[model samples]
Target: MKIGYGHMGTLTMVVELLLEELGHEPVVPHRPTRQTLALGAKYAPEFACIPFKIVLGTYLECLERGADTLLSGGGYGPCRAGMYGEVHGRILRDLGYNPQVIFLFPPLIKPYHFFKKVSLLKGRCSWFHLARAIRKAWTKLTFLDQMELLSQTKRPRELTRGATSKAFERGLTYLHQAKSLNEIIEAGHAALAELDQVPVDPAADPLKVGIIGEIYVQLEPFANHYIEETLGHLGVEVRRSIYLTSYTRHDVLSTKGDMSSRSLAMPYLNQKIGGHGQNSVGDVIRYAKLGYNGVVQLAPFSCIPEIVAKSLMPYLSKKYGIPVLTLFIDEQTGPTGIQTRLEAFVDLMEQRRAQTREGARMQTGSAV
Candidate 1:
């Protein structure tokens, strides 16, 4: 089957590798075209969520380009993602195509169960096939994951011209090709070389903003109105809490820790907040310690976890002495509004920078 996948950060990487390794023709759909979104805008109900609209555009574009099936994820609980497969299927049917949609929902291991559940998706031949597929996927996933971890570590000291982006490009390339264990190894080695080749700038003042929030909004640049790039253009260095590898790890391994998992934005909120939002708080705190000037928290209009995060951010701001701004988006979100808020945030950061440097100069004068 000619399989088509929706882009979901590094998930696209994993899907492409699996399909190619399994000998299926995998078509990478053109980055959701304007026409595709227009079609989805007309076809989707007025009330459909933003992500559904975006994903629908992806599937529609893939189908037109000759993909015979839809390869995506599965449904779980509370989160709309759990039901995205069904919703997407219904949308496809309403529009007329009933292609095969394979969702790879990773299962969690339990006390009595030896293996986890792959919800709605089954291993082709036996448990052995499933094990091999998973093992192969992990080898690729982990290597790409470690590269990002290394980046955040070096990012603070390495924020000069071309340094961080060079590292990011390398990681993206390796992740783009991470298919099998052998490919994963080769890709990582090559990426490390690229990172080493790029030199960090000595005297660069990069605006360091920490982005924390819901996973979809955080990772999908288009969905977030290209916040990272916009910030970059303004000479601000944007760091995000969402890591492709960390999200995957939590998806497969953190079920045990999930119950105790706290809010991702503000620990003071102390709510499970549901979904990956809870885990993001730890990421935010980590970034604050790493010297981010401020944090901008984005949440879908009705996302409970992020709402909880917003509720507690005042305390986080006080405790950490960092500015925290929350942006709530919904169907009505427009580019102009996002642009305005971003400009304001950047302005605020500029003021903060001036104050810090002024204070430093004052101390120097006093010493002299």
Candidate 2:
């Protein structure tokens, strides 16, 4: 079986590992681009969210490349994500590409159901092989996440603006091509080491900002116009509120973790509003308390959950005394417009920081 799946942030890497272990050839869709968006938007419902459009485009691309099986994560909440697979499958059928569609939305609450879903894909594999596949995937994920996080720090301080990014791309290529768990680990270390050697201003006090929004835009650089890297280029430190490893381990695999968003967003949103709305609200508050200079919320244009969260940004900004910038993105978005807004936001944060430090010094002098 040649398995193909739409990319969902870092989950694509993990899923690719699983398909290979299951004795199936993994069909990787082309990386998202303007053309990808155009293809997806051409056939997608006019009002569907960006992720749906992009995933559909990916599937179409995969189908053209001879992928016979398509996989998508199933959703169970009020979020449109829950119904994407069904919609995508129907779209594919209508377009004459009747690939085997698999939705990995097995009931996480029911072990038997989850195992059953796994067994179908495993074919003739033993439990041991399944476990090995999972372990290797998890290991790769850990390494990749670490390398990514390290790159975030280096992006702002590196002497050469895009050096860290280049090194990271190379490292990712090596990590992805590695055959075994040990090789993956070695590749990760090598990647980190290469990034570490990049010249950086150790004393650079870059303005720190936390990114909070829908998980897809927050994690997918292409989807969000590479907002994080843009911030770094503008001399801002970036921290995303969600990472795939933590999200998978805490939210999906285990139930024991401090979901600070639930508690932090209580004043404004007492209940889950679906998607990562709670995380959006809570993470902004958390970043404010952490002394971050500012917060930026990236949401897809017309995304209901993020739209709801965006409405509450003013209240959070006023309460925390921090600046907030919310940017809504769509295929029509232009990089020039995004870059201008980001530059303005960075300038605003720098001015605010200067005023803050000046006030602190004035207060100290008055006391003295």
Q: Best-fitting candidate, measured by lDDT? A: 2
The lDDT of each candidate is 0.67, 0.84
The TM-score of candidate 2 is: 0.96
lDDT of 1 by residue, 226-262 (tens): 6766666566667676666665665555663333234
Question: Looking at model 1, which ten-residue stretch has the lowest summed lDDT?
Answer: 111-120
Residue lDDT tens for model 2, 1-368: 88888876666877888889889888977678888889999999988888888889999888888899997767656678778899999999999888998776635555686676678889898889989988999888888788778888999999998998898888878888876888878887888898888899999889999998887888778899988889998998898888888878656665322278768988888876667777788888999999999999988888888888889999889999889999988888899999999999999999999999999999999999
What is the lDDT, from 0 to 100, of the residue 162 in candidate 1? 46
Query: Which prediction has the highest TM-score against the true structure?
Result: 2
For each predicted model, how many residue pairs clash, with residues at least 3 apart or on different chains? 3, 0
Candidate 1 differs from the real structure by a C-alpha RMSD in angstroms, to one decimal, of 4.3
lDDT of 2: 0.84
| Model 1 residue 206 lDDT score | 70
